[model samples]
Target: MSKDVQERGLEIRKSVLGAEYVEAAFRSADDFNLPMQELVTEYCWGAVWGRETLSLKTRSMLNLAMIATLNRPHELRLHVRGALRNGVSKDEIREIFMQVAVYAGVPAGVDAFRLAREVFDADKDA
Candidate 1:
């Protein structure tokens, strides 16, 4: 990826995911994982998320749905927080997961709800 793309990706990643979280990920990167980090930063953040066609809020919702359907609990939890930051109401999140339940199957929906609840509880504690 080009420097410009990586730079833009870094900006978008920080904005959506928060500096602390991104920085923590970067800090944990090693020789083996650094390439993966660079790839995601440049492609996912820079190329896709930086696009103007979709608002961050919309992107966040899409991300939540996709991750939940894929049964990616960790990613879903992170995106739950991101969805909130992007202005997706908790009610909307609940509704989204409900839809996931219908389409993605009950197990996926149950896991998504579990992960989302954990994130919500942690946020409340924080």
Candidate 2:
């Protein structure tokens, strides 16, 4: 990774993702997954996402759509919550999922909605 990208990426990840979350993710990961996690931080978050072409807001919604289309409920849920930290609103999240349904199918939407409700429920009690 470029020095600038690495510096900016760490700042972006820390600011948007929160240091505690990033630290937790790092601490919880084993040696086998270390490179995979670092690569994602260095490339996915550091390279593609760290670009100034689009705001993190746009990226968050896009990620939500992609995760939903791929039926990655776990990742989708993580991003749904992450979206808020990325400046995506709850209503915006619903709309993002709605758009995803149009291209990815109704089932994808049904699952996303169910997941949304669960997250919201857990968030409420938290």
Candidate 3:
């Protein structure tokens, strides 16, 4: 059962985060982090992202907002790329960060924008 969910999660994770990102994660996993990786794959991506109530784009937006609210710059950077791949427009992402600014504090929003800029610029380069 966990295996099935993990497999599904791996598929969703690869699709949203890109094969390169997911592959790098797996490639970097070791004794200490491998379990954590499997848990996230099974639970986060499989259980949450695999749900049908919301589309992938909506989930990506939610992730962006929540990650920004938490002030998790690293995750925010990663999810910014995922959000774009999921069909979220750059303007929409800016608006989402604006909402974060209003509710999650200006600092959080500012940092989120900074991280987003890095991701957007990388996309331009790629």
Clashing pairs in 1: none
What lDDT is obtained when candidate 1 is compared to the true structure?
A: 0.92
Greater-lDDT candidate between 2 and 3? 3
Model 1: number of backbone collisions = 0
Candidate 1 ranges with C-alpha deviation above 4 Å: none
Ranking by TM-score: 1, 3, 2
What 10-residue stretch in candidate 1 is worst by lDDT?
Answer: 70-79
What digit string (tens of lDDT, one per residue) describes model 2 on residues 1-126? 687776667677776666887778889999899888787777878798888999998998888899999999888777777788888888998898898789899999989989988878888898
**lDDT for position 12 in model 1:** 87
- lDDT string for model 3 (1-126, tens) is 477888989999999988998999989999999999888999999998988999999999999999999988888888999999999999999999999999999999999999999998988998
How high is the lDDT of residue 13 in model 1?
89
Model 1 scores a TM of: 0.96
lDDT of each: 0.92, 0.83, 0.93
Prediction RMSDs, each to the true structure: 0.9, 1.6, 0.9
Lowest summed-lDDT stretch of 10 residues in model 3? 1-10
Give the clash count for each candidate. 0, 0, 0
Clashing pairs in 3: none
| Candidate 2 Cα RMSD after full superposition onto the native fold (Å) | 1.6
